[model samples]
Target: MGVFYRAPEPGAKPFVAEGDLITRGQQVAIIEAMKLMIPVEADASGRVLEILVADGTPVEHGQPLLTVATGDADRAGPGR
Candidate 1:
């Protein structure tokens, strides 16, 4: 949420794309609010499933930016 931006700037390549492997804390997108750019990072390491918003698109608070398919280790209990 908060005005999603897939790319750093106009005509620039996106930080990530569908099927791209992402790690936690890795910047996936940017959210601009009040002229400040806020990095949107991955909560968990995973493969990107989809990008829910376009570059420079305004987004709402709590709106999903993208879907990620985290590895089983993230979902399963330890010692399994």
Candidate 2:
């Protein structure tokens, strides 16, 4: 499973599971900074399996925000 990066504040918009399929730098969610939209992106390619944070929920830096299964079981690495 992949780890989700959390926003650094409370009452922020967390990543969206149904959002666009993103790559390493694609926007996943938005955080309001000075009334500006900050885009969040995926660090790796995978299907989002679950959301750890709720909508409009408070979050902190370095917190887990979601769970993603890479979807490629073949790539699980060295332990097959």
Among all candidates shown, the one with the greatest lDDT: 1
Evaluate residue 34 in candidate 1 and report its C-alpha lDDT on the 0 to 100 scale: 85
After superposing candidate 2 on the true structure, give the runs of residues whose Cα lies further than 4 Å from its correct spot: 1-15, 18-21, 71-80
Off by over 4 Å in 1: 76-80
Q: Write the per-residue lDDT of candidate 2 for residues 1-80, one digit (tens) a residue.
A: 22233444555654445433435545665545445555566566665666666555555555555555554633431110
- Lowest summed lDDT window (length 10), candidate 1: 71-80
Tens-digit lDDT string for candidate 1 (1-80): 35788889888989899999887778898889988998888877888888877777788877878888888756421110
Q: RMSD per prediction, one decimal?
A: 5.1, 8.0
Q: How many residue pairs clash in all the candidates, one count each?
A: 0, 1
My TM-score estimates for the predictions, one after another, are 0.86, 0.55
